[model samples]
Target: MQCPLPRIAVLWSALLFGLALSAGTTPALAQAERCPKLVAGNPFLQRLAPRTVPAAYVAPRQVGLTYIGHSTFLIETAGGVTVATDYNDYVRPAMVPRVATMNRAHSTHYSLNPDPGIEHVLKGWREDRDPVHYDLDIDDLWVGNLQTNIRDWRGDTIRNGNSIFVFRAADLCIAHLGHLHHTLTHDDIGALGRLDVVLAPVDGSYTLDIDGMIEVLKSLEAPVVIPMHYFNESTLENFLTRFAGRDYAIERRESPELVLSRETLPRKPTVIVLPPGG
Candidate 1:
C-alpha cells in the first residue's frame, strides 16, 4: 500500500505551487542586497538568538531548530515534538531530543551509548535488513531510509548505510539526504514523491562532489535548498558558485532560525544561509 502524504506535505505543495505561479509574473528580488560577504564568524556564532514572539497579525507558531555543530540538528515542531539527526560528538551529550537518528558511516554520526532520556533511537544502517520506515504522528513527521554507503578518503568502499530522512512539518516536505554518495535514481525520486526543501551536504568531499551535488539537486526540483556539512566560509562560497546565474535568491539571515508559512515561502529555489545558531 502507498503511504499517504503527510498533511504538511500537502499544504506545502499547494502553497509552493501557488507562489511559484504568482512569482513568475514578477521580477526576481533578493532578500537583502547588502548581505555581508561570506566570512567565517567566531565561535560565538553558536549562541542562540534572543527570541521575540511574532505579532498576533502573523500566525503564532512555535517551530524551533538548534544546530548541534556539524550536520547534527535538533528540531522541535510546533506541536512540541522533538526530532534529532546525526546525533554524535560532544554536542550530543548536551541535546535531549525526543527522537534521535544516527548513521553508521562515521563516528561523528552515531553515539556509542544512546542517550537514556531519549524515547526513540533509530539506527539508519543495518547489515541485512531493508530500509526502516517510520510514521511520526505527534507532529506528522514521516521518515524513510534507503540503503547506501559512503566512501572514505582513500576511496575504499565503506560498508555503511545512509538514511535519507523526509520530514513533513509546517507546510513543508523537507528531505535530508544523509551522507549520500551517488546521484539519485528514478526510483529514488519516486520514493521521495514531492520535495519542497532539501538538506544536502555540499562539502564536495564527504558527500557527492560539487557537480554531482548540483545534478542531484536539479533532479529533486526542491523549491528551497539548504547546504550543510561544509566548514567555514570557503566551502560555502565554492558551493554557491555552481548556481551563479540561476533564478535563485540567497539570504544570509542574521539569525539561524526562520519562520516560514504557506504564504511566506518564495516562488523560485532559494538558498538560505542559516547562521550557526539557527
Candidate 2:
C-alpha cells in the first residue's frame, strides 16, 4: 500500500535522522543546554586535546552542515530545522532554510529580499545600532546571537554592526562569525560561553587580519573551525600557513559538507576546510 504524504515525509525525516546518527552526527537533544551563564577566563581555552569520533554521522544527535559559498552555511539540525547563515542576495543555498541570519557589514552579507516562506528572518544589525538580540526556540533547536562591531564603507565604526549567531541543538553549540571585523572582547567571549564548532572568516584583509583572527579563534577554543569568506586559494593558503605546526590540525574535506556532533569534536583543536558550494 502507498503511504500517505504526511506519513512518507515523516518516514523520510526519520530515515535521515538514523543515517546521521550512524555517521556520528547524533545530538542529545533533551540534554542540550540553553546558553549557560556568561563567564570569563574559561579553562578550555588554554588546553588542546585530541577527540574521539563516534561510529559515524547520524541524526537526532548529529547535524549536517554544508558550506554554500562565502559565509553562508546550511545548518540542518536533527529536529528537522534548517538555518542559513550570512544569507544574502548574491548567493544562497538551494534548499529553503527554515531560518535565515544576515549581517550587514557588506551588501554580500544580507539579502534585501528573502524568501517569504522562511518562518524566521534574523537581521544582525538594527537601524538604531542597538544590539540585535535573538533567543528563540524553534522545534527542538534554540538559536541566539551576540552583537559585535563592524566597519562601514568609510571605515567608521558601526556599533552592533554584526553578530555571531549561535545554534544550540543536539547537545552542541555552534557559532558562525558573520562579517567579523575585529577581535572578540572579553564580554563577547563570556556571552558565547562554550562553543563546540565555529565558522570563521579567513579573508585576512577584508574580515579580520590573519593574526587577529587567529587570536580570536584561540580565545574561543572551539574544537572545530571551518574557514569561510576567503577570496581565493591564495588567501586560504595564507591563512592555513599561519596555523602551521600550531595546536590546530588541518583537514580538507572532499566536499562542502560535514557531519558533526559533540562527541566527534577532535581532542585537539582542528581546522577543517570545506570548499565553497555554488
Candidate 3:
C-alpha cells in the first residue's frame, strides 16, 4: 500500500512556493548565490584575510600575555609566535619570548642581553646607520617595523629610533605605537593600513601629549585602543575624560591579552584597560 504524504510537509512546501512567488527568486538559486566564496585569488576573498588561518597554523588554547610594567607588552600569538615590545626587566619570568624589540630611548626601553631562548632580537637604532625597515615573516607571525624618534630628559630634541611593530595573525592586525613623539605624516598613514587594535602610550610625557595622542587615534581610527605608559590612575582618568562626548566604551578585561576575529570586533571605538596582574 502507498503511504500518504505528511500534512506538515505539504503545508511547508506550499508556504515555500508562495514565498518564492512573492520574492521572484527560487530557493535553490538564492541559496547557491548566498554561499560564501572561499577562493584565495578572488577580490572578495581579501576581506576573508582577517579570518583565515592556514592549516599549519596552530591556534593556541590560551593566548599568553604579561603586562611588563610601563610601556612593555609580551604577546604570544596563537601559532606559538612570541612578540615582546620594548623588551625590559619588568616582564614576567614565565614568558620566554622568541622575538623581542628594543628602543634605545631609556634604560627601561632596552635590555642588552635577554634570555638565550630568544632567537630574533630587533633593535630600533643601528650605529651610524640609516633608518631600516624590517619585515619578519615566520610560520604564522608577520611583523613590520618603522623607525621614529622622541625627546630626551635634558629638554633637547633627540633622534632615537622607535619601532612601530605590526603583528598580523588570527585575521586581525595589531599595531604597537612605540614612543610616537610626533604627528603621523600622510605617508605614514598610508603605510599603516586598517588596524583592528592599537597599543598606544598615553603618558603624555615621553610620547605625544594628550591632544597629540587624540589626533593620532582620530587619524588611525582603530576599532580598539589599549593605553599604556601611564603611571597612576589620575593619568588614565585624564585620558579617559577627553572621550566624554565620543561614543567610546571603556572595558576592563580580566587579562591583558584579548582574542578576536573580524566578526567579533565592536562597531564603535573602545578603550580596553589591562590592569596589573591581568
Model 2 agreement with the true structure over 1-278: per-residue lDDT tens digits: 22344664554455434423331112211111234321112234212212223223446568889999998998887657788999888889997788999998877889899999899999988999754567777765568777667777788888777878888766678989888888865545645667889999999987889999999999999999999999899999999999777799999998997888777889989999998873
Once superposed on the true structure, which residue ranges of model 2 sit more than 4 Å away at CA?
1-58
Q: Find the 10 residues in a row with the least total lDDT in model 2.
A: 23-32
User: Compared with the true structure, what per-residue lDDT tens digits does model 1 show for residues 1-278?
Assistant: 22233644664454334323431110111100001111012123213222233223334333455555567776666545567788775445254777888876778788888778888787766655333445443433334444445676788755435767666544456677778887765545544566666778888977889998888888888877877788878998898887656677777767655555545668878887776653
Compared with the true structure, the alpha-carbon lDDT of candidate 1 equals: 0.60
**Model 1, which residues run further than 4 Å from truth?**
1-63, 93-95, 128-130, 152-154, 158-160
Candidate number with the higher lDDT (2 or 3): 2
Which has the greatest lDDT?
Answer: 2
lDDT minimum window of 10 residues, candidate 1: 25-34
TM-score of predicted structure 3: 0.74
Choose 1 or 2, whichever is better by lDDT.
Answer: 2
